[model samples]
Target: MALIILMLALQFYGVPHSSMFTFIFSGVSFEEILSRQIHLPILWVSYLIIPNFIILDAQRILSKTHLIQLRGFQYSHLQFELISLMGTLFITIIYVLFSFTWIIALMKMTHAQIFSFAGLKEMSSYFLFFLMILIGLICLVLIQATLNLFNSVLGIILPFSWIIFTSFTVWKFNPLNGLMLLRYSSYNTIQTFIFCFIIIIVLTTTFLTVVRKKDFI
Candidate 1:
């Protein structure tokens, strides 16, 4: 509900939709602006809200179970991670669908050509971008889970700090030159995919190791 209101306010205030993409790229052309308008909502939701939700939920679950001992702790940890992944995926899909629908309505209002080949290409790229971010979010959540298990304070601080640092880097340095976790969001599709794949593998392995060694109580 708040997300919807924010979106409406942005639209009502005539915020340049492409302005969001400027954080990722140095300069965006007119055609790129159109493409961005079709996809920025998904990026907004994934970057701004999803990670916090996952981390908070992990914290809530941990708080409740800290004093309880399950017969199969390892299995329970795996299930928790799996459930988080599924929930994130489901939310991402629903948000993306809503974003697409909103974009279509805006296009119709402006009488933009909706069935054009270029539009279709942009939509395809949006889905690719969505997939990359989805994978990255999963990796992030797993890392958060591991941190939460090891040290709850660090778990909370690190993810929030990473996000703040990423935003600062995006504003202060050239995104192409800066090394940040979210730098991949502005990279080529293949590069983003490879980076996400590597991060997921490393984070998942580290999470499993940490969960196995750490005492839950």
Candidate 2:
């Protein structure tokens, strides 16, 4: 809750008043918002940090309870992974929904023009873009957690490094590049979504397999 508020405050402060509506309604992708390309270093960093908050909290819960839950409670590895994945999904959904809701509210409050038909139509596109980003984040989180299960240091480094690396590069077919796929990539929304879906499924399956095999001491 506090972190969401902090993100709101940062957006309100870092973004110029005259450009707030443009920033909201304009073609600002969530990736750009998270990257240093925005020139608002603090805001971009804060955006990236939000996912780490989720990662750290999820890790804490899993680490603290995995042993007891598996041994004492007689939970199967598949059962435990399912519970953890469900928890992650729940938190991700809530976080993304709340973040976007507040952003939309802010846009509406500041730019009354959004109530118009055209603005509302444009808003739907943003929703789809956000959904893509949400799925990408989920994949990244799961991949990170899976790595962390094996080695803590590598877990944080690889996933985050990819995010930072992608932010700096401009790849047209980058499935993770939500708006870029529409703007520059040959792949359309459906194609990008298919790729993302595949990635998520692969990552989830791999994570579960690892959990089953890993001797969590």
Candidate 3:
């Protein structure tokens, strides 16, 4: 309900004349999508809300003992990681589709074409830019899952606090800045994607290590 309300408000009031691409990139031209240095509070808030759902989905996956203990279907820690990842991707995709649906509808009603990039190069760049953003979201989800496995309270408090803090700060020196898609122009798409991919790898290994070290009660 809250997400829907925010999406509607952002569409109508925030960057009403902008294109669907604005939600991902900050600049006016395709080339600047990865080089512009502007902050988008509306996009920031929308992206922040998504991680909360991802965390909840991670928690649900981690909490299910029956799913792990099914007869003849042994699930290892790697399997758990895969399941949680699938859940994260599913949640993120749903949010993206919903946002685009509302955006296209609003675009039609206003009879406006905010940003036009018809060239093959522009389309591919936009796709890569969008992929990097999704990778960041996946990082957050995996981080939440790993934290939850270590300690439940820290799992909830840490990720939520990070989101709250990042939303207010304009500092670029922050280590977790990759999660801030609005300012993604700080680094190119492939660079940020590689950085996020490394984070995911580390988190997955840590999660697996923790799961293996613990004794089942």
Each model's C-alpha lDDT? 0.48, 0.58, 0.56
* TM-score between model 2 and native: 0.70
Best first by TM-score, ranked: 2, 3, 1
Cα lDDT tens digits, model 1, 95-174, are: 54554455556545544444332122366655654465455455556556667666767765665555444433334332
lDDT of 3 by residue, 93-152 (tens): 666556545655665565445445322134455455456556766676677777777676
| Clash pairs detected, candidate 1 | none
lDDT top scorer: 2
Off by over 4 Å in 2: 1-45, 64-66, 112-121, 179-188, 215-217
| TM of each candidate vs. truth | 0.56, 0.70, 0.64
Candidates sorted on lDDT, descending:
2, 3, 1
Top-TM-score candidate index: 2
Query: Which TM-score value belongs to model 3?
Result: 0.64
* Pairs with steric clashes in candidate 2: none
